[model samples]
Target: MSNSSLPEERELLRQIARGDESAYTLVFNHYSKQVFNAAMLYLKNTTPAREVVQEVFLKIWLKREAMSDVEDLTGYLFILTRNHIYDSFKKQATQLKAVDNFVQLQPDAIEDTDYRLQERQYDHLLNRAVSSLPPERKKVYIARKEGLSNEEISHKMNISIHTVKKQMQLAVQTVRSFVKQQLHI
Candidate 1:
């Protein structure tokens, strides 16, 4: 902090730039505690604070050549520390948003699954009821289900229109009652 130590710190930065491990070690020892404490205050966790300390020191070492040009080393380190904390908070927000989206979709996913299951049950019950119909009624019911109009069914089966309508009405009533009973609706 004093101007008296600036020359000594400059020499240390020069040594670090020239791949001097001892000078790098001295720099780490001098700054690591401060960096860790700042990180801990922001992150409120020991593990992440320690990680920030290691990352800050690693960046300082990796960018040692640029360090020599930094007139205010402490200010540069503070900026780096602040940027890293901002990055951590941004990453946490993104992860939480993804989790929230997934949570919000859960009920719709459950409802779709339940709907598919109920539809399958309804189809099975309808098939059973139709299979139990008498031969003449079953024939008329099948024709209607296959998209044939009442007149078309009458012509195809060589039956009168009135008979065709009567058989279809009975078939429909039978299926409706069976479905209502089986589904408890």
Candidate 2:
């Protein structure tokens, strides 16, 4: 953090700690795009990559005072973003595993058309439940499910960043509630 090296990031961190909007913008503009691109390499989706970048910046801003102590800002953000994306992928993989397990447990040769019909019915009901979401929530859910970020969602929908987050939260809560009731999970 000496004046000789990383002076720019140090200054930006200090200003950000003092609630400087311009500093936040500067840091975000400089590093967020890099973070987003890195995330996109793993996530393969703009929305998710954007979300990872926003989450990275949000964490930095919220913990700006401690950012000076961070040995390498770029390295820290890179690791944080990577971990978050990996965690998301893990969760998605778990959900898919459960669905696959359900399919595998069904008696295939014993029960023929009836089982397929029932599975189709379940899928139909799930689709209907998702479609019942409020428009914004549904949009956010689709974007988030596909690994989109708050920034990407906001840009795509032409809305404020905060609004996109709210929509994402609502979508999660609504889906969780519906899943509990429908699947008795």
Candidate 3:
């Protein structure tokens, strides 16, 4: 923990809370790599780790008001970093394209807020459906989606590969079923 980094980080967070772009840029350059590396330690994927880093900074800029109560800026960022990476895992498991450009890259025109609202609603339903899965299934789903290899997941969870695969399959099926039943689509 650099003493310079701590005060600099705290200042950046304060400026960011006021919607200052230069502060965000300065801070992003300073800490993005650390955030990426930390996330990569947990996520172990280049693309998702990068994406999570981008998201964490964006969220920090957007929600910097929470910083006043925070003691350690770096610690707060690490927690946010982990949460976003896990959310990327959930996004991968529940849908697809856990990247920034994917939405803009949608094949058809989604230039409507109402349509976007429905998409968000569907995403909510999907999350609820996932939450409703059995605990083992949810764990497997999160692990796999976070880019953990099946063998890694199996070893970490102390389960057999066969069991991991079965639980994942069951989780997928259950999520799909819940979506269909609840949303009729």
Model 3 per-residue lDDT tens digits across residues 79-185: 88888877767877766544545776664555566689998999899789889988888999989989999999999999999999999999999988998899667
**After superposing candidate 2, which stretches have Cα over 4 Å from the reference?**
1-7, 104-185
Model 2, C-alpha of 143: deviation from truth (Å): 67
Clash count for each candidate, listed in order shown: 0, 5, 0
Question: Cα deviation in Å at residue 160, candidate 2?
Answer: 93
Against the reference, the lDDT scores of all candidates come to 0.86, 0.80, 0.81
Could you estimate the TM-score for every candidate? 0.83, 0.50, 0.45
Q: How far in Å is the alpha carbon of 143 misplaced in model 1?
A: 2.6
Candidate 3 to truth, TM: 0.45
RMSD of each: 2.8, 30.1, 27.2
- Model 2 weakest 10-residue run by lDDT: 1-10
Residue-by-residue lDDT tens digits, candidate 1, 1-185: 21223348888888888889999898788877778877877888999989998988898888888877877777777778888989988999999999999999999999999999989988899999998888889999999999999999999999999999999999999989888888788
lDDT of 1 at 146: 98
lDDT of 2: 0.80
lDDT of each residue in 69-138, candidate 2, tens digit only: 7677777777888888889889999999999988887766448778888899887866777798998779
TM-score of decoy 2: 0.50
